[model samples]
Target: MTSENLIKYTQLFINNEFVDSVNKKTFPTLNPASGQKIADVAEAEKEDVNKAVDAAKAAFSRNSEWRKLDASARGRLINKLADLLERDITQLAKLETLDNGKPVGDSEFDIQCSIDTLRYYAGYSDKIHGNTIPADGDCISLTRKEPVGVVGQIIPWNYPIMMLAWKWGPALAAGCTMVLKPAEQTPLTALAVAALAREAGFPKGVINVVPGFGPTAGVPLALHNDVNKIAFTGSTEVGKQIMAYSGQSNLKRVSLELGGKSPLVIFNDANLDEAVEIAHGAIFNNHGQNCCAGSRTFVQSGIYDAFVKKAVEKATNRKVGDPFGDGVQQGPQIDKASLDKILRLVESGKREGAKLETGGAQIGNNGYFVQPTVFSNVTDDMTIAKEEIFGPVQCILKFETLGEVIERANNTQYGLASGIITKDINTALVFAQSVQAGSVWVNCYDYITPQTPFGGYKMSGIGREMGAESLEGYLETKTISIKMPGKL
Candidate 1:
């Protein structure tokens, strides 16, 4: 099916059925590439959240098909979903590109990674068993790891399908039902994935996708008393709000993967060519919408000038325009608000006395295409260095020694991820160990895989996603004890 056909599944997915909301309200989702409306998705509100929650709660009830099914059966179902996702890679990539305004190449990569994540969790499904405990008496003691029941998942727009997989993979593996809310800006691929999950023979209410605004759908889902947990990947501000909502509601478990202004440090001994390319990709990937993007580029004072010049050249050469265009490396920001914010930050960088090396302006008056911006001679106090621009803007700061760079890198409130480019193993190992971020890269940047645990420290997030640790967020541990007969 073409992306157009794929986008027709824009209705709210509830109880394995694509249906209109209770109020029949809808919102138009736009294509960031052309500033055009692709489709009017069914807008879910409080009532719709209640209905979806009811479905998920019922599916999570003991004796329900989803709960009573064998562990391996759940694994098989998830694997089948992965198979279908792989089969429709092309069309899914297209949907992602159209809705998200990311390069088609990046979309394809995300689809593949999403498949890998799902399959990874599928292998983990039957393996999630508790253990027997030894007691001081003849009594038998054991523990069972069980699903945390119904969950509410709120994912961001920067990565529509990939974030869906990140949220769904572990939740499904743990045998939990969920009501997910896709970002209002990018909901097409999410709705399409919901259809695939249904085709994978998941029981009704096993998964629900509600497309709507944050205040209406997202807030209600977070505050729902029946929701056993809320797994959210978005802004730290919004994550804090959800945490507050969880406390106000039922004190439900909450796992958040929030924002970051991650750093990428380069030592003097680092290969200049590799360092330049790695630094470029670190910040420019996904148009710099990544939470753990290496926004702060700290270079050793000896090579700072050379690195800045080459970094400017790299940013200037980066291709920006149509997402589907051949050789295009950059695309529009998600919407007007994002574009405006990036431009605003770029202006602040210039206003606050940081030298603009190259490409600080928007491409045209059409779609939200931003120029790949670079700033040199940036001090730690500069706006570009202090705040997360979250754009294709690299702020190059000079550092004298390892201790200084590590201290500067750890100064930010966000500790999602960081990187260091150096040839010396001691430097790399020491920097990695010293960084407060969740994931650290030595030679490369953004080296994320399905099997690795990904999350943040401090304000970045509350829990990990992907890997074995993610399963803990969706599971609850229960202990059972048996008394032996004294006569025996």
Candidate 2:
């Protein structure tokens, strides 16, 4: 698909209507692959955020059609949205590839994942239930699960539609009205999906999308007193700031899926060929912009040299070009700032004495493209080894024993995911139990499904994203106790 064929939706979606920002401000959303302007998007500031919050609050009120509808009806509406998403997956994927600079194939995968996530949550809309307790002394007691009044969601540029699904699915399934702030860099897909939500017959003010920068739209959403909850997927620093904002305001419930420097360990007994492929895809997928990318790869000393050679070969052979081009496995970074950050981190890796195996430089002149970089002989103290580079840079660290590798892997403050490639079941089980990460992939990497809960340990933020656990974040529990007179 060409840029001319792609559709642009630039207005803020509020109360089921596309409208200009209150201040009439706008910003240019760029095509990161060519450093060109894609469209002029509406820029939402604090005033716009307030408007969205008010809309959501009105939709969540008792008298509103959204709150008065049956839970099954709500589920049907969500399912209709999912159906619409599946029908328009092609256009949505192209828009995502154009706006976010991810490969078209990867964008398709993201769209499919989003569709699956929405369907999964739609199945649970009416099934969200509380407990009924058998009480004593003729008193009946029960618990009810009710929706949190209004939610504010802020999503990242990478996997924009998928993250929107992750946050929106549970919130909608739990019957919460929400105002979403899509990342300023890539708001096209979110705006498009908001239109789909409206088409699927969602009530006015039940869903809203506000596209703007973090400091303006995001901060106001988090700090809004009327918003009962906030869900965010982004950097650990920004996640922390949102948590503080929540506390300083109404102590709104906050759920965050933050950064990671996840470790992928390969043992000597593993299948060498399979391990090499998994490790390469784990670190280099989506140009390694994934928060759960296995950036720190720990290989056994017995096969470290061979693994490094094979990894370098794979990185050197991978295609990096336009996201829309055929057979392009790697694409440009999201923007110039992200491109500069990745380059700086790669330079730090070289200066800190990590051996650059094969690729380590920028690729093109006009856009933000980086070479698939591999650093061998990397120590734990190196800047690249310790930081979440969020780029297609791999740091291979050699380990002598299982115990040592586990210790080294758990040393990082952020623990989102880990992977172990080993033939021995005993070793896999031991490592899985000991790792501090939220998800441990045995003989696999990045195998996420809608049924599985995704989150992290330590500073990797709070709460889960996908699965049934996510629905709980958007719901509140109320217990009712009744006293009955039996023989009076």
Please, what is the whole-model Cα lDDT of each candidate in the order they appear? 0.93, 0.93
How do all models score by TM-score? 0.98, 0.99
lDDT by residue (368-394, candidate 1, tens digit) is 999999899888888788787778888
Which TM-score value belongs to model 2?
A: 0.99
Write one digit per residue (lDDT tens) for candidate 2, span 1-488.
46676765789999999999998999999998889998899899999999998999999999999999999998899889999999998888899999999998899999999999999999999999988899876888999999998999999998999999999899999999999999999999999999999999999999999999998889999999999999999999999999999999999999999999999999999898899999999999999999999999999999999999999999999999988898999999999999899989999999999999888889969889999999999999999999999999999999999999999999999999999999999999999999999999999999999999999999997999999999989999999989887887
**All models, RMSD in angstroms:** 1.3, 1.0
lDDT of 1: 0.93
Indicate the worst ten consecutive residues by lDDT in candidate 2.
1-10
User: Which pairs of residues collide in model 1?
Assistant: none
